[model samples]
Target chain A: MSNNTAIKIENLSKMYRLGQIGTGSLGQDLNRFYAKLRGKEDPYSIIGQTNDRTSEAESDFVWALKGINFEVKQGEVLGVIGKNGAGKSTLLKLISQITAPTTGAIKAKGRIASLLEVGTGMHPEMTARENIFLNGAILGMTKKEIKAKFDEIIDFAGCQMYIETPIKRFSSGMRVRLGFAVAAFLEPEILIVDEVLAVGDAEFQKKAIGKMKEVSNGGERTVLFVSHNMGSIKTLCNRAIVLEHGKLVYDGTAEDGVSYYLNNQNNASEKNLLQRTDRIGNGKLKFTGIKMLNKKNKSVNEIIAGDPVKFNIDYKTNCDIDVNKLLFGITFWDQHENKILGYSTDEMGITFSNLKNEGYFTLNIPCFGLRGGTYNIKLIATVGGTKMENMLDNIENAYSMTVLPGDFWQTGKANRSGNMALLKGSISQHNE
Target chain B: MNKDEDWDIILKPKRNLLDINLKQIYQYRDLLFLFVKRDIITTYKQTILGPIWFFVQPILTMVIYVFIFGKVAKISTDDIPQPLFYISGIIMWNYFSSCFSLTANTFTGNAGIFGKVFFPRLIVPLSQITSNLIKFCIQFILFLIVFFYYLNSNAITPSYLIVLLPVLILIIAVLGLGLGLIFSSLTTKYKDLKFLMQFGIQLLMYATPVIYPLSTIPAQYQFWFKLNPLTHVIETFKTAFLGSGQFSLTGLLYSCIFTTFTLIIGVIIFNKTEQNFMDTV
Candidate 1:
């Protein structure tokens, strides 16, 4: 309610009905009607659980978002970070009015345009020129406004030659660029962009981040951005909020928010990894536990970039089958779910023939080459050299490890703001 | 609470059922215009005949009606030329049916767009009605050409009541739009209505005086036809242009009242549905 505040959300919650969904029983409709007739609240909505996807529903309803409250100042670029199904998108959808909340309200200043997707409402049969107008109008731009900036949008997208051509013929990257170009020209006071940059190529992503900065840096526009990419969040957002299980868990500077999310979040690491039922495969061999160890082999989940580390994956075999050419692999994915580093015992031509019923695979690295960030570790155990490589166990997002910035090259300075991988090489001056 | 008044927008869990945002729809008039343009243009994108299909469609339907209902069934055309009588009814009924069916699919058909963006949801159905009107006008020209041919032979006479043509069209549009909105809202939750809508429109067409003149029906059943708002529209349209068929001020007045109520109720349900239809859809 202050003069500088652009948006204020008060205890906003969205409850969704689970199981036997959308069939819309007449009995329930009548129940809801009777409740309303008695001047009472919705009967089914009053009792529900939190928005946790990992657990079975205790009731027929689940709160997709619950008791979420935050305030964004004008000209502030706020990044919303959370794991999938953690209410990040539900919050954005609520703020953008794509769907209404079940309880509470959001009061905001000025016009709000959300790019929950790029080229939303664009017709494939329409020419690029036509889609620009259509997409622009869908994003709340007038025809005259689109016409005035038509050339700029085309130039920005770098598709002037294909402006007359239908966009269906364009490559996926070209379509993204064209869509982002029109959206960028929309000068709404508040902009909600939800992971639209994940589709475009690298150069276009850079241009999009720059445009977003320019829009917010003008001291007039407010932006709410949601993405799985933490690098963009740290660079583009001045402040950030983290939602976990539909609750506002962290709110502060973008740096602290990203660290808080990475440090406190892990899928099966907190509980006994052996008890996790989300794993998939033939289950002939199952991963019992995965641990990140320091040089002394002590368990540690956080390490510096240049530190020596080992990934110890404990497994147990189910049957007495002879294990021939068994492979143990561990893949490290960055925050964006891009595979940054992966190593398999078979890659080094060192395959075990007969594995014990219970054993552990240790992948040792003399120097951890990944830059400072959180990486998810996926464990896969397979038996090769016999009848088309049988996968025994595959556990995705089994563990999350935090990598701190360090002197990977021993240069006393850190390599930041670049690719996620680090390398060390020797250079000597030579006269040629 | 007073301080909250300054905010540009306030989103709440429940809004007034009657809180139809006409101002917002007006503000997004350009979107409506573009949607109308998109519907009309993309419909004939790769078709060979293009807009000529607009003419071919009604002409074909007229010929069929003339064959089945006129020659085979012996349905009366009130002594007017078979083509003119049927064409007049065909054009008017086509406009109503197209408006109803197209607008009825507004929520389900545009779910992809509706889910991603936030605009006045009313603009979509408004655009459907608008674009169908454009198609109707093109088909109306076809009707006029046939009307001129009949007029030269003294088979038909134009009345001053022809001035009410715009009013009659307005009633048909409102009736279709209203019922379409109501059905569209229902289809989002109960998909069974979608199937019902397909055959329901066909059956409703028979209940109105489309293939046969109002005189062909007995007086007892004619009252039931009058209960259908479209019957008055079709009757008034025929009486004004073709110089035969029933046209009553009271009947037109009854349609006006019926259309106004349907529109109000349709908008109420539509406004309610658009808010959270995405969740169900």
Candidate 2:
């Protein structure tokens, strides 16, 4: 470890037992004890698979994190990006010492405070003032430290009138603001944050990001931030690392990391969509497959921004009850999870009645309006005319597509880096 | 990494089984104080009676014990007034019981906070012990009121061993904390132990001489009763305040030794369990 190295992680790994703990642990413990007595390795430790939630367990143990090595320099803002089960949180938990790793070690300089969540120990019945102290103390701040920054925290949270009100009475936005304010002032040498900004209103999120930027720019503190919001990662992080299947697959600049993560999502569509477990619905109707087609109706992975394209969504009705008022929708979202464009059958007053058990719906667009960027598609099907009460299916990121830049306004120059969508319009100059 | 490196903290896969990290615990003393204050302040919040519940629980238990054991069972109260006798034992027993039960759920109860934050996990159970001590002090005042009431009637005499009041409280606390720590660590692994613990404290109380004097027990059964460390502490409490119950030096010494052993074993197991209880809990 060097003086400039704020955190040095070496060969860190964590293995978690699957299924029920303690049910068959006694035998495993005995096996481990026997192995240790015979001067051999633990029997169960050697047999395990990677952390993949969608797969069936072939063994009783899985390595949540495996042989991870990374170094964070002082005053560096490192962003960690990964899929849902890619061991990002496991890595943070290890660095924060919430749980000990199964193997390897981490050497850290100065105090390390992790905001795996804000208001971790806050009581709902306590006033905001009281909870601030409690939350600060839980985040490793002394009472004197909290008292010194009490006015600043209240000012930042902007809940001066509600300081004496119990947090239960405050709006959730206010609560998150209060929690984030307390955490922002923690002033630990190494701060680990995990998606805490996913909550709170937009204004508070901007303030929090600004606070985080300020904290890292102090030239003495280091920060490790994890979020699914690619926009924040690109804006707030100087460097980023991408984890895939419990392994560090990419370590580079934030822009490159975001692009690497977005590009990696393209391969996930190769799996049969029907077998996807990451969907939300009542299971009345399910999306089985999605095909992106160019103007000639030939299936293509990449679509030009100004070109005509079509999306064919294959679905199957689980039961025979669906008849009329079917609302089928497809939404396009950027890598930052911002909804870019949405098209629904009801928008054109088109309804499919008495749908077949297994059929496909095609949405044709004369001009695809998305800019040149990778986007994800979410498929939604509802029975009750665009109302969410009878939502049959909602699958987020069911399909990933890359759009190439094109002249949408018939101009020779391609319009890039303006916004997510391009609008078709003609402006006439007035002789004023 | 070289040993000469000036890293402030080195997190490792396995620490010594007995590593309790007293320095870390000391560093987070403010958190412990906050936890204790939270428990004390929030437990009775929004209630009409507030901290009055502290006085009500023990007094109600004393009244019931006086009726059941004093009048119905005809068990001797060591010739001390029934209310005076039972209240003293009740206050002492209440402190230990509340502390034991509360600390026993340290791992399972605070899993949310423990999962998110890194601090000395021992601070939680220690806070429970401290908060319960505050409650015990409040109830002791009620006991003293009853003691003086009996004193004016000249019905009982107080002993100079009364100075052992603080020592008696310390014994009860250590015994409760030790056993609670042991059970808390075990309950994280085997959740069924939690159900046993709920009724286990009740069963253990009968084995101690809480409602009756040690003299009421037969000679053959005295050894088993004496084996319970609480037996000596409650007996000494009653002997000091009421001047009627027995307080042998050997019994007190035996209780202290038992408490020390339990605490050492409890801390060892607790420190070991806190390392990875989040994974299982």
DockQ of each: 0.55, 0.51
- Report lDDT per candidate: 0.86, 0.85
lDDT of model 2 at residue B171?
92
Docking quality (DockQ) of candidate 1? 0.55
Give candidate 2 regions above 4 Å deviation.
A265-432, B1-5
Candidate 1 residue spans exceeding 4 A from truth: A270-290, A293-368, A371-420, A424-432
lDDT per residue, candidate 2, B101-208, as tens digits? 988989999998889899989999999999999999999899999999999999998899899989889999988999999999999888889999989999888898
lDDT of 1 by residue, B113-163 (tens): 888999999998899899999999999999999999989999988788899
Pick by TM-score: which candidate is best?
1
TM-score to true structure, per model:
0.84, 0.81
B-chain TM-score for every candidate? 0.98, 0.97
Worst 10 residues of 1 chain B by lDDT: B1-10
Q: What are the per-residue Cα lDDT tens digits for candidate 1 across A161-220? A: 998898899998888889899998999999998886655665886687778778867878
Instruction: Report RMSD (Å) for each prediction in the order shown.
Output: 7.1, 9.1
